[model samples]
Target: MNQLERLRKYTTVVVDSGDIECITRYKPQDATTNPTLILKSVLSKKYDFIVNNAVQYAKKMGGSISQKIQNASDMVSVGFGAEILKYIPGYISTEIDARLSFNTEQCIQKSIKLIDLYRIHGVDVSRVLIKLAATWECIQAAYQLNKLGILCNLTLLFSFAQARACAEANVFLISPFVGRIYDWYKKFCLDSSYDAVTDPGVLAVKKIFKYYKKHMYQTIIMGASFRRIEQILELSGCDRITISPDLLEQLKTQNFSFARKLDATKIVTVVDQPIPLSESEFRFLHNQDAMAVEKLSEGIRQFSCDQIKLEKFLLHTL
Candidate 1:
């Protein structure tokens, strides 16, 4: 079997895009969409109707751009996700507003609103994993949401502390960013100063994976934001991998066995360790972790920016 087939035995492949057609080719187990992906899709000629519907939604509001913009955001997500849900048998992740990442209560409230919106159209809540940022507030929100029978995908994770916090809080899953870490090292390093053998992102995920394994945390690890096929291959045994369509297509063309690279059984840690993190401890852990802090902020900003672009598209179409 080829690498994709070989990797399938150990990992659940998830397509990371908004276009259902793009995802159908690889037959990923699940699919994920952020504001960026949806915004990009609406801009493309093939999905212009998404923009049209969102624009009509905005025009009906007939208010300030802010109000219409807010409506536009929701409409885009619901519109794209409604269509995107058809190709995958599993869940489709729909992210909440990134600007709400710091407000635990509002994040939960908005996520619930999103779920209710989806349900109004006969979409099953079980097939939707509300995506939230890995900020302390977002995780807390996910914790509460999970209690309310809502599953969440904690995203923008780049540190072991973030993973530990998410797992400790019993969040459903975490998306450890790989491409952004690679980008950071590539931009910072001189020639020959970097190696995928010791890539910082790889090390981050490995640390989190080992800790999760050692502690028997059930929170799934879905590696995201990969820059290359090698990084995906390196994370072969992760709980799930969300790959972009281009990378998924490339993997389909490759011929070779992709052996599992990270088996938790190979680790030598002898004792089961308990993480004693109260609110104070969780804050301390989150504060001390720079990657989680910085990247979480940056990711939210980028996603929020995409939301703005999507709103602009809605206005012009109106």
Candidate 2:
């Protein structure tokens, strides 16, 4: 079996792309789309229809320019997600606006709105995972949404505090960014070469996986933002892995053997103390971690920029 085929035996591979062709080719169990990906897809020829349709719908929407832009943005996001769902049998994650990352009420409202748009496109809410930044308020919002039978994907997760909060909230899934963590460490390292087994990003997810399994937290851990194939291979037995098409394709051609690195059935020897996830504690702990604080803020800012650029692109199509 190729790497992709072997990897699936240990993990549910998810295609992280906005292009339908990529999703169709890899046949990932699921697909994840973000503002940056959607923006890229909107510019492509094959998926431009989604953007054009959203623009037409927004022109008829009854709202101010700001509201129209917001509606169009949501439409484009769900539109891409809904289309991607047609190819994958599992859920498709549609991210909420990064600007709403810190606002609990707004995140909830936007999540509901995104689901409603999915409904308009004939997609069920259960098949959708509303992606939110892993803020304390956003975790609370996800907690509420999960209770209402609206599943969520707590994204942009970096620290142990964020992972613990998401697990405590019983979120549908949590996307711990693997590559972004590695990026920070590499930039700070005096020597360039880093071992995949010792990679900060890989170790971060391993820690979260062990914690979740030790306590038997039902939340799914889907490692995201992989920068290397070794990073993905290292987290082989994770609940799910959201990988880019480029990496997925790379894995498909390599004829190498891989083994599961994480096992839920293994003895839990790690410290399993329950971490405090109060609002103050979350902020304090997050602030203490230099990498988490810097990367979390940077991720939000970068996604917000892509979202604004997407809104502008849609405005032109209007």
Candidate 3:
């Protein structure tokens, strides 16, 4: 069997894009889209209208770039999520701002607000996965949201501690970024590691998977941000892996052998403990994790900037 088919045995492959047409053709199990992906899609001739609508809506709102951008981001996200839902039966992940992650209250409020907005627009809440940074606040928000019947996908995770905390909180899913971890390893060269199978990012996800499975943690682990086919091949047995549309197509066409890399049954197990985090504890813990703190902040800025440029491109160029 090809690597793609082999990988399917252990992982549910998800298409990481906002392009509904592409998702329809690729036929991934689920789909993931963020500001970056959405913005990239909106830039194309086929999807440029989303940006125009977002800009017009922002213009009607009349406020600072931050406020207008928030409005515009919502417009853009709703457009992609609603349309993408037409192609995938499983949940579509829509991200909340990484900037809001540090504040548990805001994260909780924004999550509810976004879900409410979806319901108001007649979108099925069951088909949506609200994506958030894997910061303590975001996870805390997810814990509450889960109890209230709203599922979430925790993103931007890098460390085992972050995974442990996320699983402990009973969050619905956690996305341990594979490519970013590989990027960090390449930059630092921890122990002079440079193997395809042992890529740092791949290793990070493996550790999280082992920890989650060993603990019998109910929280699902979805590996994201893959820079190479090697990374995806290495994470074959993860709960889920979100790949860009082009990569998914490449996987479908390119013939390669893939080995089963992760098995929940084979890993040594740990007692499952359900530990809920208080608001204060959540804040303090997130503050302690410097990697999560920096990445979340950086993701927000990058997304927001894309939002601005997206609007400008739509208004002027489109």
Candidate 1 lDDT score relative to the true structure: 0.83
Give model 2 RMSD, 1 decimal.
Answer: 1.7
Q: Which stretches of candidate 2 lie over 4 Å from their true place?
A: 269-276
User: Which prediction has the highest TM-score against the true structure?
Assistant: 2
Query: What overall lDDT goes with each candidate model?
Result: 0.83, 0.90, 0.78
Task: Tell me the TM-score of model 2.
Answer: 0.96
CA displacement after TM-score superposition, residue 221 of candidate 1 (Å): 0.4
What TM-score against the true fold does each predicted structure earn?
0.91, 0.96, 0.86
Task: After the best TM-score superposition of candidate 2, give how far the Cα of residue 68 lies from its true spot, in angstroms.
Answer: 1.7
Error of 1 at 187 (Å): 2.6
State each model's C-alpha RMSD to the native: 2.4, 1.7, 3.3
- Candidate 2 per-residue lDDT, tens place, 1-318, comes to 999898899999999999998899889889999999998888776777787778778889967888778888899999999988999999999999999988899999999999999999999779999999998889999999997789999999999889988888889899999999999989987875888899999999999998888888889999999999999999999999999988988999999898889889894655564765788887887788899988999999999999999888766665
Clashing residue pairs in candidate 1, if any? none
Model 3 residue 201 CA deviation in Å: 0.9
Sort by TM-score, best first: what order?
2, 1, 3
Model 3 RMSD to the real structure? Answer: 3.3
